[model samples]
Target: MTTDEAREFARSYVRFLESMHELAGRGEGNEVVRRVQEHVGEEGRRHSVVGRGFAPFEQVNVQVALDRWSEQPERTVVVEGVTLPPHYGPVTLQQLLHGEALPPTRLTAPELVDLPSGPGRTTACVRNGLFLVDDEARGRFVLFARAPQPHQGEPVLQLELAGLPTDEAQKVLRELDELRTRHNVYRGQTVELAPEMHGGLSVVFPELPATERADVVLPDAVLARIERHAIGIADRREALRAAGRHLKRGLLLYGPPGTGKTHTTRYLVQHLAGATVLMLSGRSLQLVGAVTQLARELQPAAIVLEDVDLVAEDRGFGPGSSPVLFELLDAMDGAAADADLLFLLTTNRADLLEEALAARPGRVDVAVEIGLPDSDARRRLLDVYARGLRLEVSDATQDDAIERMAGVTASFVKELLRRAVLEALEGEAAPDGVVVKDEHLIRALDDLLDSAQGLTRALLGVRDGAAAPGGGPEPHPHTRQAYASSLSFVAEAGPGLQPWR
Candidate 1:
């Protein structure tokens, strides 16, 4: 509790006692005063050092008091929440009421008798500088420290080592004994903990598990960029070694849909051995509080947001499409301020991002384009898929259809080949598993063409041309470009900048 709160509680309790005293002075033998005295001086006390009273509540009573308390703000109390690791000790609840910080040093056989408090509830144990008190009945209770000893300007402990001695040891020991005197570690000197102490708040932050690593594949160029960035991080770290500072590196990947942007990010997580990564999708940012909370939770880890266009939508003029995007911008700046953190974003539409956000230099240090797979990449992509299918495509003639399928989108290539393989495995299983045929390829292609046609109409704003007399297909960019180019070549012979239409 704050100093003011302590003063208030003390004032209130004194007033209560004064009222009881006045009631007792009436000389009518009031039951209320009698009960007050019963608890105060008559309060059944097991032991007392000074005027303050101490009572150990039964387990049921303590639980009842804890239950009545509101569980809001989400972080109050210390029951199931503050989990102490087993390595601390096999301490009991009775020992905690006695109030002592647990000593971490393991005791040797010779030093067993030197243990303070004679191995009872008087001595305490703490882990990671956090002290957990074992209540007589309430089990483990984390004691809030009043104020931590100031860490700043503290003396550094110096170590002096010497081998166990014969004659030489005796001489060194005698000299050391004369120079320094041994002191006793006293226990049972009570230190009270207030509820609002900073020590208690320090224990509220949950511990995170170690990150697990996995192998992921990426394009060679993307992998090369990752290596260069890794080296840059190492160089920055070396430069800041004397100052003990960390460096931040951010990369933004922009590309069309069906590209391997997400895969590339996973590859980086695998490559950076000690790095922790939290992957969030753009849709999750739409929630009012999710963005800020996520930013805070993901600090000190690489925050990878996929499909950033969902967050940075086109709101037409200057007004934002979503308030969360502004909050996200603030979060990005906050994350960047920490020298050790990095933020990586992947998006399909670069134009959708705010101009101010996209133009930031250090915010997005390396803006790489994950373009569609080239012919050679397609060849490799097919080979990767073929290995998964366990099919031996040893004959060059047999793979003409597969070769034709490359150079498009990775998603399309993987999906089409997977469907063909599924079709080939309809009947009995063969030694080589069913060999995917040209017919299966044709069927997959037909399905892909239909899907592509729909996508094209949707994206290019093509309609049924219902307004036209014949109801023909609407004019499109590809047709317009082809027709205008053909006429331009004809016109170049004579007229210029005029179309045949």
Candidate 2:
């Protein structure tokens, strides 16, 4: 037959099929539907066809496949007005079948969407309809449709290789899969497991600014250890791998509440730029395998699992143990030793973790305890958090205050300073010109040390004896002298003079 004749015949056949589909849709053509199904089944038995089903809203994936398939441009067939999976809306299906751009109307409910990368929350919308995307190699347009209800009843993706052999079609599908991976939706973004969707994760693009290493209130030694092992190891992967040491390392940060564990993790995240950061905690830990696989694929990735003891609790002790712990272990063991993956796990209850996980050499190479801030560390924390405060006092008075705050937890120091600023602000009608003074701190301490606020103060890391009416230990004679000097100096220097520590 001539090329024109063959084309006419193909068009005629498509029209006939469409008519049959329409008749069946109206409930008057059961025989036609059966026959079409039988014919499709017979063809499938005769030829090796490459096909996959994607969610109707996953237009980007379908578009990538279509772009890859459109290079040869043999024959294009489109079927429309079909019922798709219940999860898909009618508009999305119509857009996919008609090759029209997706409407701006939101498809995903507000709660279902992951955090967006932009300033405003982004609702899930199909960005484009079926379109061509160019790759270095082959190109092909795809046939995408929402299958008719009472039929297969799903969104279908098919790559038509009109006269090509089975092997050639398989090669095309493989190439398309590679392209899909290259354009992965989650690449370069943080992700968290979605328990609602089994085996799937939701994207979480944290807008957190990178924290400074010095700003983290942990001990210098502990900070140094984490910097060397977790952040530094990721930076010098090539050098370590060349020296016969593997790049994969696990560091566990264990501490009580408000002890700067998470603060340290944020510091590491800031230091390790260009690496994928996977933040998992709570029920999301079930996706350990999926997260590890992604980390392996995207090397130089960091997996920050906060409160890991929730899942890694000692398996032998009671019913609270998580079955996902085994999965976590498998994922850790399965990864290549030199893959440049960093596992940073944090937990308040380190003693509750399984010994196998904690003691294992490759599983946890370094464990750092982020204990309560010591006297000197507490002094530094006070200095760090009070950076912008206008303390109308002399250096000696500020030193006396810091010395009085010694042995307080970092959490207490932070809250104490914040409350002091608030107290200072309360005394002035205009906040623009308010300056915190020694009396403000004294009043703030008095409020916090009230007998009724004992529990609150304890939760904030105030020791039992430290919750006295005046707050902190009794000042020595020299400390009181320094405070008097500070008051005199403040009166002489004027109200806005900034206190130096």
Candidate 3:
């Protein structure tokens, strides 16, 4: 009885142990399967040796580069993380691998990135997903992320080349560089960089028609010099090089406001249609280095810096002057003489420009002063602006009227013609079609002569204290009354009351 009982208990114990072992084996197998899945996932591939190495902070640029590199959607691989910048909060590895949508807790503060040819203050989020960036270097690129995880120390980014050979990868990189250089991001575009963000610039392609050379009010001598130095040099690059002349040239167009400085620049831009043109002003001066680099890469390029006095302001003036002045000077000087780069800078306050910039040999080889248009030039400007309209006045009367507009700026003339057209349209005598009559111009001049428009006229390049053809500044009724009262007070007070006191 004892032996049988003992044997039954032993058998039961062995059965229990076998069941436990089977359960443990299943759990171990499940654990192994999970590990395998994690390893083969997108996140796992990001850390693999084949992945292109990049910093996590450079995810945007990397995405752009990769998107541009490969057109095939399947071959492109991306990984994202918030690890490199240090300020971004931690993102768990699990959240990344599972293709989980980043929760509000994981998102870093949104950043304002200046977009090319778009509205101001576009927001960029630091999260896990695919992102598109219009880069200055690359036209546009896609930042792709499958499952991105937070990392320690210096974060790394890797692009998986798939089965691409070393030679092919190199060829692709070369092609990418060439593509970036060949297709200009800022050609025929106006752009400004975001002062708040590093390396953030926005571009706007202006659909501006090419201004005719004859349309500009600049002197033919000034235009000729500019054409020869800037446009002509590019055209005769090989000849100039053979003649021991370098293609890199800097020309400064300085003049009072409302002159034809900018107009001349536009003509040059149009003249060099095949050349890359990069226009920068205001905040965009910060990107001078980048602009120069691109210009060098894309030879036969023109970089126009409007209101350059904002940067090249006299260092002695005071604090808050742009630090970019030195950078600009260096860029101009550093560029290779044979690069076929033209720097066309315009400024209303050229007198205030630093001597180092204005007088420097290579910085500004030619300083062309686009002064206020004289009588003949002013007449031409009027004629150009007044084109496509039937004038009520005869040629003789028009010439007389234009002569009377002497001392008025080119800007003033253009504005005057525009106002005249507007007046004609609004007038009861105005025909159904747009026809500008002599009375319309006279009325516009009368409006300009009003004391209220004195400041505006001055701003439009009219000389201060200059009288219009109709008359001097016409004081308002209230002002006339005040003047009369003051005169009376002065007379009544006599010597007893000092007006100064």
**What lDDT would each prediction earn against the true structure?**
0.40, 0.57, 0.57
**Which residue pairs collide in model 1, if any?**
38-42, 38-43, 39-43, 93-135, 100-124, 101-124, 101-125, 102-124, 102-125
Clashes of 3: 6
Worst 10 residues of 1 by lDDT: 49-58
lDDT value, residue 296 of candidate 1: 38
- TM per candidate comes to 0.45, 0.67, 0.65
RMSD in order of candidates: 20.2, 14.8, 15.1
Q: Of models 2 and 3, which has the larger TM-score?
A: 2
Off by over 4 Å in 1: 1-219, 230-246, 286-300, 313-322, 336-338, 394-399, 437-443, 450-501
Worst 10 residues of 2 by lDDT: 104-113
On TM-score, the leading prediction is 2
Per-residue lDDT tens digits for candidate 1, residues 276-366, read 4445564444321322333333333455667776767523223654344555555665553435555667876655553545343335555
lDDT of 2 by residue, 259-316 (tens): 7888888888778867878788876776677678767877778888888777764242
